[model samples]
Target: MTDTNRTCFMKGQGAQPRRDRSQLPPRKMATLIIVLTMLFFLAAAHNAAAQPQKPQPERPLVFVPGILGSRLVDDNGTVIWGDRNSYLNFPKLEIAPSGPVTALHSDGRLVESINVLGPFWTIHQYDTLLHYLHSLGYIDNETLFVFAYDWRLSNFETAKQLQTFVDDPKRGRLQNGQFDLLSHSMGGIVSKLWMVKEGGAARVHKAIYMGTPFQGSMNAFETLSDGWGDFTNFIAGGLPTVRRVALSFPALYELLPTYDKCCRLGSPEKYTPLDVLDVATWRQRDWLPSEYRANGPRGAAFERGLSEARRVGELMRQPIPGVAQVMIAGDYFDTGLYLYVPTNRQSWRDWNFRRSKGDGTVPVWSAANNFSSIEGTEPSFQQHATIFADKYLQNKLERELLNTAPPPVKHDVLGEIDTPKHEKRRLDLARADLSPRIAEPGANATVTVAFEFETGVTRGDVQPTAQLLQRGAADAPITLVETTTDADLAVRRLTFAGSLVAPAVEDTYRIDINVAGQGDHAVFLTVLSAGRRQP
Candidate 1:
């Protein structure tokens, strides 16, 4: 599973019913077919009515949501994390600056899954998906259920709780011991871990993952690396305080990018891909929580968190026997598929983004098991936040839920999944260079970029702009400067460049020459300590 190649053993399927019409005339055959279809449907209705299971023909459903999807509460049932006015309050989750780095708590438990944020702003989270399912005839607590767990804990704990919740006779345990699972984002990983690691496959019949990061996501890495500046996912809003609050969640680490060849070292034009999961990589980059780097229990806990992330990542790619899996991904928007990481192994900071097709969160390839299998949603330009509410995707979802759609066929066992080849397509990085790479924090640096476009993308669709964005999990990404792009015919490449004051901290930063509708090129600049030289 860690390698994304677990073979699922299919159980014997029940024989299909057959009917013969050759014995009747054409007119009678048509009449008989209609009559028989009506009778068959009536019988199904009757059985469903008489059955002890929920009155609907639909099987029981367990709905799990991604991290921050659930509301958190502490002792005395006081609201902790899921405040509707969280933007202003920024309810703190205490992570001692340095200590044992134990999973923080206050008699913590899941109060409910998050549905909306910024009550005044009326933002939506799971409300759209939940209401859509309700319209499709999923009854809450009867035919449908939501599993809410403290997202701060490891997925192992969450998965174990899932096993307990599903098997509990008073709750989700159905008469036939079967249910369909609908999970969004991080919940997909949680559900997968339970089905594969905790042996919940015996009960789950079908699992639909919507915008789930089965392979992992760059957004998660970005959020962890820099506090959440992802506006699409308002949970990680661009505020220094909010960024610090999100750093303590173990679930965030679990969501780190695990796909193959996800990142490269050095400048975008001259870089080499590296195995991003290697601990040494994180160590060398100083990506681990700096608070723990001084040597303490918290440091050990941080390493443990990474280890758990690798474990969950491996288990996520594994298949559960008898459990069918379908991934619904949004594939239209330019997503940051891979990154150009700074070669400065001195300290970890930013993941300079290079976009391709994705849900604006999880890349299409990442959602489709790194293109190891096909996904149900393809070429749909829907954003990740509103994907479940998309009408086209809703129809596909209804078909999948009723088992009416044909199961996705995997690529030839010995052959690879037909890659959405980028060799001759996609925005290509031609050249990106940075000058005066040496700077102390808070100094200015200049950048120049040259890029070519082979994709059919046009400027009308993406208003190409260049920005020097802030990095790290403890501050919002404030644009230091915003610039525009133009054609540099002399160089035969599209060019955009800008300069801005370096972050007023000693660390590695980047200069991004972003081309809208095309792609971006990132060149790193290490702002050294008072005296340290760039390696």
Candidate 2:
């Protein structure tokens, strides 16, 4: 039995020996499996290394708004400067009683005011800009900020404060410690002062300025000399209150026309420069009575203020250097160029002031600084107050801010469409009864236009007529007839009736008004295809 069992075991027949796990497969197959497993892991690691990561965010943006664009509040949190209700109340609600207008400060940090009191009192007016930035993925406080200060103070003082704000460690550092700045109107002056005087040039990567009065405005001089006139009475409740408040600020005086920069042809022989503070000049021009020439304590205050303003103007004449700047100016609206000498004694209502191309507040020459190093100067028909809301201007600003390369020097001057005749006429189309609401091709529409003339202009003499035409097509015009006239000589209404056949393509159409002796007036209307809906 032992011999048989030993023979069987030796021949691997009686009891099979346990097979080793490592030897289950052939040697070449085992090597191949190990190689394949290693290759799989290696490929996964390589793929992970090749994948792209998310991009880093853009640099921070800071907005500095123009004058009267920041709310001033008292210690009790009652608004003093930005509250339109308070302004309308005027002397009735004295700001002095509530304590001088102060900023809301906490823990040595300034909390910017976000209040915007309607269209008239547009203080802290950055809601649209902030919203646009946010939509582009910029977080509030982290990437976007508004630097607001007492606009009544000197721009130099405000510039120093801006330096402090940018250098603060509590606020997150911008890309490479550099930021983009967007400023408007008077804020441009403050930004310029900061860059030129406060070493802000090194910290800023790019700057965009809109409607900056670098060369000063003649309108400013006229304002200080004659007050806001009808504008203050109609829009601001009273002239005395606004005049008193405006006079207290030295910044307003700094905005007075710099005689050397603002002189135009007066008599073709001599260039007459503006002298706002001179009482004799006002009396000679018949702007005010001889007795009104710098009289009483008010006049003494004005003299002192003018002295400070002169110093500011001198300092501002120094050009800002070593910074990438983009200047945007507005034009094509009626802006005061020079005051016309009165033929006879006439009140402020009849005071004829010649106007030229401007933004209705700042002349084109002043805003563009006579075309000095302007990266882009856009001539908009919009007024000064409404220029900020223009779509073209907003797009231009956004593009400039986002671009890494320096902006191309572009001076786009959209020429005037229809020159407004005598500004006193205040001839504007009221949108109250505009017909069809939406204009489409092959559709009939009726539009009612109410035009107001000056007190002295007669309806018979005006002979107002209107015509409808496609924007680019001059020859194709639909004649509009006079529908009605107001009993008052100063008021008249016209109507345009008929079907305006839409062109084969979608385009904009316009309403052109011809006041025989006055001038031509035009307002734009959009015309869409018959089946298409407005986007």
Candidate 3:
């Protein structure tokens, strides 16, 4: 049977049983009807408030996260991958195989694994995207959903799954049998496969791609051949995880540089059609033992993986006729070129890494589809990792997804000049009025905290709140206060104040300040106090 036929058969086998509404009694049925009606209206009102005042109904949004973005956990709730601690301690921990690309559930409700962490810090994947959409009044599940799949699988399989998700009768199908897609990096490849091979053009209204390597990334080839490098390994915690990721995942092989379309290093020369196995053998001579040269299991796997990748790449080059495509490519950073110099045995470097412009991972030419569809490309200075977090990109995505009017076709380099600097929000204690470092019981003190935003960022409508709590009792709030924004200077400041009262017993008290909205800032304060004043 054909792949599409096999996919349909598999979907049929896994189809979930629908709820039997007819089983309810007459009185229960009447109550259910009333409850459902009330819920429907309440949800409608909530959506109305969240979305812009446009005549069109809110279209459903399906977000596809990039590589290492989805949380992988076992049946017992133990994380398998995508968690910093788990990944770092991968050898020590009982690493469980990711069962399948499936949805996570908690109490019978869908649980989203939208973001993952690097070795030392959190690497936000789609959290910023989702938060921005939510701030614009997009309701979760009702109007927004995430497609979290195993990044190890082929794009073809993932594309098939996306097809099933969009066509599912019970919980799929947004408004008017169409939806908007926002894809980042590798997710864009998956989206392209779905649109081209799985007939997603009929269902997708607008497809927005951010920092997508449509042609493929030379970095993938480098990482698989040489090593993940110090920076990437440090970010991923160690080389083991990177090695496992590079060798195990078929998807990464799909991201190999499309040589035929890419330019050679140090010049604007394009390469001839190159075989995947030949390139792999040339690059990984030392890594791949001499015995397993061309006909070994490793070589066979590479051949198989490359074969599938080539098939997907061929299909991806074809444009979806009905769906509107928006390609957002990043520029400014030095990108890897198609050229690679083999310095010595098992040693190579990208030829034009110091001069080529890209998003630091994907070269600009590759990100722009080698200028094949340059008329639709939107270039920005933001790096591949930060493109989705960019407010400009967010605004553009909103306009394309929500507005009724068709987005204008403009081939221009945007946000390249006077590029906005991205920074993390910070909260700090500005002032405090405590006569004595150690206050007696019932003694009162006032504390003030300040939240500062980066130059380009503006504070959202949701304000910050300050709460005072005792150690070991974070659930209870001793005192609480809200913040007021001061946007007088280039750097906006949000100040929060609260009064703290000492308890009857002698102990240390903690003050916590939290801001709402995406990239929220938080601050904590510890204060020591004696027993209440002697009566």
- Comparing candidate 2 with candidate 3, which one achieves the higher lDDT? 3
The C-alpha lDDT values of all candidates are 0.61, 0.56, 0.58
* Clash tally, candidates in order: 5, 1, 3
Worst lDDT window (10 residues) for model 3? 105-114
- What are the per-residue Cα lDDT tens digits for candidate 1 across 1-535? 4322322222124445334555777898899899999999999999988876422325788888777667655445656555554343343553543521333332323323322233122334677677788877787778877887777677898999888777777773454678889888788888888888887888877888888888888887666555533332343344444444555566767877788767778776788887665657766676565554537435665667778888887887676778777778766455677777877643545567777767778888877776665534433334566567555566657766753453343222110111234223333334455666657777777775544444433222222344554444442232323232343333323444556666665544544444332223345555555554322
Query: On a 0 to 100 scale, what is the lDDT of residue 535 in model 3?
Result: 19
How would you order the candidates by TM-score, starting with the best? 1, 2, 3
lDDT of 2 by residue, 1-535 (tens): 6976776776676556556687646888899999999999999999987986322235688878787677656567666555544344333322221233333321221223322123222222455555666655567678877787877666777888888878777676653478888887888888878887787888787888777787667676466446644433434446555555565565776676663525332433454454655544444554432223466435554565566666666666676665677777765455776654344543333444566666777777677766344335665434565466555565566566653333443432233112235333334322113355446656666555444322344333334456666435664555554444455443543333333444444444555554443333444444555444422
Model 1 residue runs over 4 Å out of place are 1-57, 87-91, 95-119, 172-175, 230-245, 344-346, 372-380, 403-535
Candidate 2: where is the Cα deviation over 4 Å?
A: 1-58, 84-86, 89-125, 174-176, 221-237, 259-272, 277-295, 298-300, 340-351, 371-376, 403-535
User: Model 2 lDDT vs. the true structure?
Assistant: 0.56
Q: Please tell me which predicted candidate would have the highest lDDT against the true structure.
A: 1
Q: How close is candidate 2 to the true structure, as a TM-score?
A: 0.59
Assess every candidate by TM-score: 0.62, 0.59, 0.58
Q: Could you list the CA RMSD of all candidates, in the order they appear? A: 20.2, 13.1, 21.2
